[model samples]
Target chain A: MNISHAAKASGLPVKTVRYYADIGLVAPAGRTEAGYRSYDAASVRRLAFIRRAREFGFSIEESRELIGLYQNDARSSADVKKLAAKRLEQIEQKQRELQVLHDELKHLVRACRGDNRPDCPIIDYLG
Target chain B: MNISHAAKASGLPVKTVRYYADIGLVAPAGRTEAGYRSYDAASVRRLAFIRRAREFGFSIEESRELIGLYQNDARSSADVKKLAAKRLEQIEQKQRELQVLHDELKHLVRACRGDNRPDCPIIDYLG
Candidate 1:
């Protein structure tokens, strides 16, 4: 199939398909004589796997590693678990940081007068 | 002061100071006789403000609005409150989205066997 057909089959945008090709993440199985991208069934499966990993909030690099493990029949499940654990740790760290920002911002918003006058604690605190 | 001095005083890297200048978020006060970037105390203050806003997870655009509000003494406190409320809403939305991803990924991780064997449910599900 063509790049468009591959993208459609994989439920990804054409632009994303091109980007994945450009990034060498999930390039087409072959190129046509006319220099157009070609996708075999296996390539489309890889694309779908990438799409699923991305939907689960995996970064490109993480998706690449996961795809690597998927492609290798001899790959251990431990490696995949390690990557997932690392991703979870990162998400947890961000959650903690965002929670701090949310709490502080909520406090400042509560203290602000939010009136027509220029006396706002929010601005003052930020300033 | 030179850009380096201003950056040091503001606790920002010189490259970041140059980036701020390039993006016009916090340009230097003037250019020296040799066309070198020069920063006054006031410009340093704005850079500091931008740095702080970035630390709090504000986008460069949001920091620009905040800096504008900070510079305008006649700005109504209500306007500041509005911006803060908008930011709070965005942060809340992200937190919820991250929470969903976290929960789903955690569930998958828990279901994975993560052993030396190649029979991994995570890869099976993702695939």
Candidate 2:
């Protein structure tokens, strides 16, 4: 199928399809004689898989690694598990950092008087 | 002071100081006759405030709004509270979303056997 058809079937935008191709993330299976990008069913599946990985918050480089693992027939499950573990660890760290920010902001918000006065702890904290 | 001096005093990068000036987020006090960007102490303070705001995960636009409020002496604390509350709500929503992703990924990781076999539940899920 054409790039448009592949994008539609994969539930991704046409621009994203082109970008994946440009970045060598997911190349089309073939190209038409007229020089337009053409994709096979397998290509579309890869595209969909990448989309799912991104939805799971994998960075583009991580998605590329995942794709590599997906394509390697000799790949061990341990490698995949390791990658997922690293991503999970990063997410947990991020959650902790965000929790700190949330607590700090919450405290400042509670201290501020939401009235006609110009005195605001939030502003003072940022300032 | 020069742009470099302002950036050094504010603990921000020189590139970031130039970018803030270009975006009108923080303008220099004046320009030297030689066309160099000149900044005052107040500008350095504002730059520091903006840097702190960004460190709090506020978007550039949000930082701009906060700076505006900071500059306005007659501004009511209610407006600052509203903005901070909105940011807090967004952070909570992001936390929830990240939690969901973390849980889902964790479940998939647990189901996978980290062995030499190519059979991976993580790959199967993405595929």
CAPRI accuracy category, model 1: medium
Per-candidate chain B TM? 0.93, 0.96
Per-residue lDDT tens digits for candidate 1, residues B40-113, read 98999899888888887889999999999899989888888888888899899999999998998898789878
Please give fnat for model 1. 0.78
Number of residue pairs clashing in candidate 1, backbone atoms closer than 3 angstroms, sequence gap of 3 or more or interchain? 0
Candidates in order, TM-scores: namely 0.94, 0.94
- Model 2, stretches more than 4 Å misplaced? none
- Share of true Cα-Cα contacts across chains kept by each model: 0.78, 0.92
